[model samples]
Target: MYVRTVYATGDPAKIDESLDALRVEAPKLLADQPGYRGYSLFADREIGKIMMGSWWESEQAQRNSDDHLKERRAALLAPFAHTVTVDSWEAVVFTPSLQVQAGAGFRLSRFDVDPSDVDLLVQTFKNTVLPKVQAIAGFEGMALLIDPAKGRGSVGAFFTDRAALVASRGAQSAARGEATAKARVTMRSIEEFEVVLVERV
Candidate 1:
């Protein structure tokens, strides 16, 4: 699996509105892309920093999406690019393994599971959370890594920018209330991070 991420800094006032726009617009725009799969977005409240993420079956699919025509794709993304910085990359090693350099702006998440409910947890994440989150705006891609043998898992997303990352949640605001309640029932521990760079094997 491969990931790409982008973000922006230096603009605080425009942050909230931009993030919300990404949450609502991205999925509707990118859902039909040939190699498209799923994606996620996030925000760091302290600095008003944002991250946009997308996941693809291979690095090539991601590259092709970038080849998208500007004029044609503008309607899908016109709202999220107000004034944000952007970066992209692929994942190497997250925890148990060492990482290789692939690109920039990669995010790695380590999720702890309940020993007694490990299998159920994995199922819920795949069946429940994944579908709901993928529909959000600024969500260009997503990938989930699981190790049932060890009862642990890791998930990643590719982004366009910090604004997109922050706005991802907004894209699904219509369903946010219900999604939150469901997550509280299923998740054990969720950890979020910022990836500086990545290397490939």
Candidate 2:
């Protein structure tokens, strides 16, 4: 599947109202469009940020939806235009084999794997962590990717919220103590990042 993420920034105080509007109205407006799978809205009051993400079967589906809504949603969003910045993009590495719960949000976490432990790392993520995550309250989905050319790796995707991610992260770290220790001995480093823009799709 192709995924698109858009960030709309506005006054922190207004995030709740904006999110409420989208949660209640946007789906009703775009539900039947071709290739449109679904969407989720995220609100971060502390940072004055709001995110909108959607999944589509193909690039064409995204194009169609964007074009169909450009004129109409533009007017609906005008009042908040002054504080919003919109961005969209496609996914480079994605896996559809995983299952996630409903009503979840998204996140992008980056990890760098040590070459010697790569295989073990992959197995643990696919066989263990992934399952535990799927069972969480807003657990949505995730993608684990390796940047062979760059000699590094990363995971970017979604979660229901920061708390869900926190829980999963803790459980995974603890569950794989021995294996994780072995990997860490050969480890380079790891970092997590939030996806801010999805430009292509």
Can you write out model 1's per-residue Cα lDDT over 86-185, one digit (the tens) per residue? 3344443222223322121233455544456555554565666557666655454445554444554555654445555556544433333343344332
lDDT score for candidate 1 against the true structure: 0.49
* lDDT to native, each model: 0.49, 0.56
Top model by TM-score, which number?
2
TM-score of 2: 0.56
> In model 1, which regions exceed 4 Å deviation?
69-85, 93-201
Which pairs of residues collide in candidate 2?
88-198, 88-199, 89-198, 89-199, 89-200, 106-158, 107-158
Candidate 1: worst-modelled 10 consecutive residues by lDDT: 96-105
Residue runs of model 2 more than 4 Å from their true location after superposition: 81-106, 110-140, 143-162, 169-201
Residue-pair clashes per candidate = 33, 7
